[model samples]
Target: MDALANAPDILSATAENTRHREWRLPRRAVSWLQVLPLTAILVVLFALPTLLFLVVSFFDYDRTGIYPAFLLDSYREIFTSASTLRVYGSTLKFAAIVWAITLFLGFNIAYFLIFHVRNPKIRIIFFLLCAIPFFTSAIIRTMAWIPFLGRSGVFNQAVMGLGFTSQPLSFLLFSDFSVVIAYVHLYTLLMIGPIANSLSKIDRSLVEAARDAGASRWQIMAHVIIPLSKTGIALGSILVITQVMGDYFVVRQMSGGQSASIVSALSVEIQAMQYPPAAANAIVLVVIVALMVGCLLRIVDVRKELMK
Candidate 1:
């Protein structure tokens, strides 16, 4: 009688365990299902295109048509040509200058917004003001600078009226000066957003403790705030760097015909149906950018920071 009673309980326990495992198997599969769509999109859109470019870059091209052949001529021309070297140097220089300017402006503005602005509504208003320029098209915004910075434009007139200079500044428009100005205007916001997010996550109590421990404001900022906010700085730097590096339009239009970016040169090649060389140029640019981003990742570990 005792054995019969225990057998029913044993059968019930086994059934419960079996149902639990069945439920768990689908739950595990659901996680993979959630990730599948994004994986498919990346494979199809990004991976396939990149692989195609790599293959095409090795082929031969002529005035007749592109020929299927593995050749290093395209890369050789890129590495050997003096014009290519000069353009690459110019683009790198512009990227560095723009990165520095944006970092300074972005950090200070973000610090002010997060720590100094006590009112939430005022903070929102300030952020909105920062973003207002983006409401217009980037091309329109870029073109607007041309008129403003032109010889007969508002800034020159103001400077002349104020006796700052006797002549309209020729360097103000269609020059490297104008290119840097436009880049700063366009990309400072990218830095500001990331830095502000990092700043917001900082603990107030830590700051207060540091303040109470005879630490000066500057010391606290240097030791406590900056260290904590580096992830944001790194992220912002990456964004600003990439944007400046990849820019063709701002550099072309703002600097007039005096300057040529890597992209602009590649675009010219593409226009002439120089597919192999253009593909090679693209691959080289991608590798250079990847190396830069890799350097940044090595420094900050953006993935690790975000997880915390």
Candidate 2:
């Protein structure tokens, strides 16, 4: 009789536990719920806009207006145009140069802050100093370079005053050099932010262990830090590349209209009421950017690297 009575109690406990679990959701379902808002926003904003452009890119258009139809002429024209090739080549060149410069600056700066600095307060202060420029308008920042880099600008005046040169440097403003300078100023922060975040999460104990094993700073950085920071470096490179590829004004103003970006060419098409061709350009640029990012991801399994 006692054994039979205990069986009933055990059954009741199991049933109660099952009932409690019924009130909880599966982890996957909870994950989906968490992402629902952003997914909806992306579908509405990015997805819908991209779809709209894709449709317009296929439509027929001319001097009269855009017509509703499917055609390959827009893509054909874009692919066939030598001007399109030149603009894209120029944009890629800019992206590549900017990515290299930003990566070096960002990695070194982040490394110093995360590893070299013992004081948390000073590290944060230095990071804030790097970010302080962002509080001002980007346009103002780009234009400010004019007075600092022009023939009679601060930099030129300083060089001449110090007898470094007989005349002010002409290439300092309104040239490819100036465009690069502006890009580095604007986008280096993007690189620094991602890299700093990645470096911060690294296990400090591993670095110490490496040092105890007689690993020099260079060896530790080569074998440990660089391997660990791949995700950050890739992310920073992506940000810098994309920003340089899509830019218009900085190149235009700083280069003195001598150079044009893919987007600048696209902007020209838009201004001329060439919607189909402009939409085509937009789609192509998106594809190119996506391909470049994809290549970076392939180079580093960023997901696996970060999780580890």
Runs of candidate 1 exceeding 4 Å displacement: 1-25
Error of 1 at 25 (Å): 4.8
Clashes of each: 0, 0
Best candidate per lDDT, number? 1
| Model 2 lDDT per residue over 1-308, tens place | 99854754565555556665763444445456556778999999999999999999999888989999999889998889898888888888888888889999999999999989999999999999999998999999999999999999999999999999998899999998999999999999999988988899889999999999999999999999988888898988988898898897899889989988889888998999999989999999999999999999998988887777
Clashes of 1: 0
lDDT of 1 by residue, 1-308 (tens): 99855755565555556765576665455555556778999999999999998889999988988988999999999999999989999999999999999999999999999999999999999999999997888888899998899999999999999999999999999999999999999889999999999999999999999999999999999999998999999999999998877887888899998989999999999999999999999999999999999998888989999899
Question: RMSD in Å for candidate 2, one decimal?
Answer: 8.6
Q: Point out where model 2 deviates above 4 Å.
A: 1-19, 23-30, 303-308
The local lDDT score (0 to 100) that residue 242 gets in candidate 1 is 89
Per-candidate TM-scores read 0.91, 0.89
Clashing pairs in 2: none
